[model samples]
Target: MNSPSLVATASITSPHRVGCQAGVQIGQACWELYCLEHGIYPDGVPYNDYGDGNLDPFFSETKEGRYVPRTLFVDLEPSVVDEVRHGVYRDLFRPDDLVTHTEDAANNFARGRYSVGQEVVRKVLNRIRKQAEACSGLQGFMFFHSFGGGTGSGFMSLLLEKVMEEFTSPSMLRFAVFPSPRMSTAVVEPYNAVLHASTTMEYDHCVFVFDNEATYNLCINKLHRAIAAIRVKKTVQFVEWCPTGFKLGINSGPPTVVPGGDLAKTNRAVCMLANTTAFREAWARVNLKFDLMYSKRAFVHWYAGEGLEEAELSEARENMAQLERDYEEVDGHDDDLMDNHEF
Candidate 1:
């Protein structure tokens, strides 16, 4: 038998109630889906005795034959995690895997990265290390977060930096929810998103950008089927040195929408795994917004008060600008070289 390729997932959210709910709900949905796929119940018990599916990628068997998810739910505040503790799928997760703090990030990226977030980072890292040690052959990490929130952007960036430094070999994939201007909850979202993007750009190997406005439009305007196509040969562009692109997969059935969720019920669904230069568009737009505020130095004091240096902000802006140019250069290149080579 081949060694199990264990992939640990971390669901981190901002201190905002909405962000927290989104993250926790997504985590719960994924756990439920995994259990359903593997013939396991919500309490971690198998449905029947004869099922032989490979559950090692996201689960670990306990002494009582119960399967626990190799997933972690983290927040800067305890209310969200407390819900998980009392939730229906509570039994599926270990108590130590749910990490939280008494203080919140207060919608400030600097606070999340430098102040309040630092207090719980060590404990969270210890738990993550224990999870890593339990795995036989660890493959990589999958991070679920939002770019618009404080903890999601700043705290997640810090965690990604540390994880990249320690793991080194495993590929890191991010499922990042980008903020929409029309639906934005916080004014500092642009700043948080840009800074987070610049900080974690080099750390993440692959990122699937999810836009709230775009998804809403797709669901409202074109409601028949969920078909999102990105042509790698023409529309998509990848970095020359890195293995980056998009992989399209169409599931046979519709997505399982959680109760009281915002998603619309559909007949079909499509998922796009991407690490393309096209993501630079998001960076560019957010950077433009960042410039609007940074030009006036609006609300810069909040971050500065939380130990963020003026030079770091400037550096983050420049880094994202440079990244956009890098993507443009990659996009201008011919696909001939990539066609002949293999990643």
Candidate 2:
């Protein structure tokens, strides 16, 4: 019952990369959990405090799995690479994981830079393909992106098409969040979003949608009702299994949820909520602010502009409330549909 490994890829330009940051957190958490599970005590703490962690990267293997950890980083900005390589998350990501495919996309839209984005992704995908060739039982893929920008939307959609085209059998899930309309992004976000919508619908087995506005409101006005604790039985698993990379699989757990840092904590929480019977009650404590750290925006003028009035903002709040209701209903329906079939 060992779950397949996950390959979490995010464009440097998009905020969705925040979710991909879990590689660091999960690795640490898993080490701690492993030490606690095993009889190891270093300075009275259960973690990788005892060994160099190089001779053996993993501490345990059971029905849950002990995947060999490796990452492939993809982005178009050299400056972004500098930040990641020399920044706070250096410990979470390895030097080899950074692909160094630089493409300037600050002032462009998805539709504007479609070709160049594809070229950059081609290089990164080649690297992922190499991983697929080398690794055994490498399950499916989980793509993280926001639909409101050029790289995340345009590049993400293209990557999905290519992934689906090359590896037809593996399942793909898109973890998508919306860009703020009046908050602080390009007005063309609407355009990038609409362009990405068709491709996303075409490729993804499931598109888990979240909105900045709704999450913000939940943390603000509904902190008491944020996403609650998840309830899963020992044998249950949410994601499927596949033989190919960038494809679908119903037999394995999502790699994003297992841990290291990008969205390790949040995805773990999400997987919990995704399986439980109490949808609304379980949706009681999802930390929006914590996840917001990955949401980097170059557009600050939107906040200063008068183009988005208070009336629009009020309506936006209402939309978010309605969206949550829709999510609860859909999530439950999805569970039922999946339960009827086992692949």
TM-score each candidate: 0.82, 0.52
Model 1 TM-score (2 dp): 0.82
Question: What TM-score does prediction 2 earn?
Answer: 0.52
Whole-model lDDT per candidate: 0.74, 0.47
> Per-residue CA lDDT of candidate 1, range 119-202, in tens?
988888888889988989877777777787778888888888777777757777677778777777788988888788878877
> What would you estimate as the lDDT of candidate 1?
0.74
True-structure RMSD, every candidate: 5.9, 12.8
lDDT of model 1, residue 217 = 70
Kindly report which residue pairs in candidate 1 clash with one another.
Answer: none
How displaced is residue 328 in candidate 2, in Å? Answer: 15
lDDT for model 2 comes to 0.47
Give candidate 1's total backbone clashes: 0
Show where candidate 2 strays beyond 4 Å: 12-68, 88-94, 110-113, 222-343
Candidate 1, after superposition: displacement of residue 255 in Å? Answer: 6.5
Q: Write the per-residue lDDT of candidate 2 for residues 81-141, one digit (tens) a residue.
A: 5555675445444466676554544424443245557567667778667666654565677
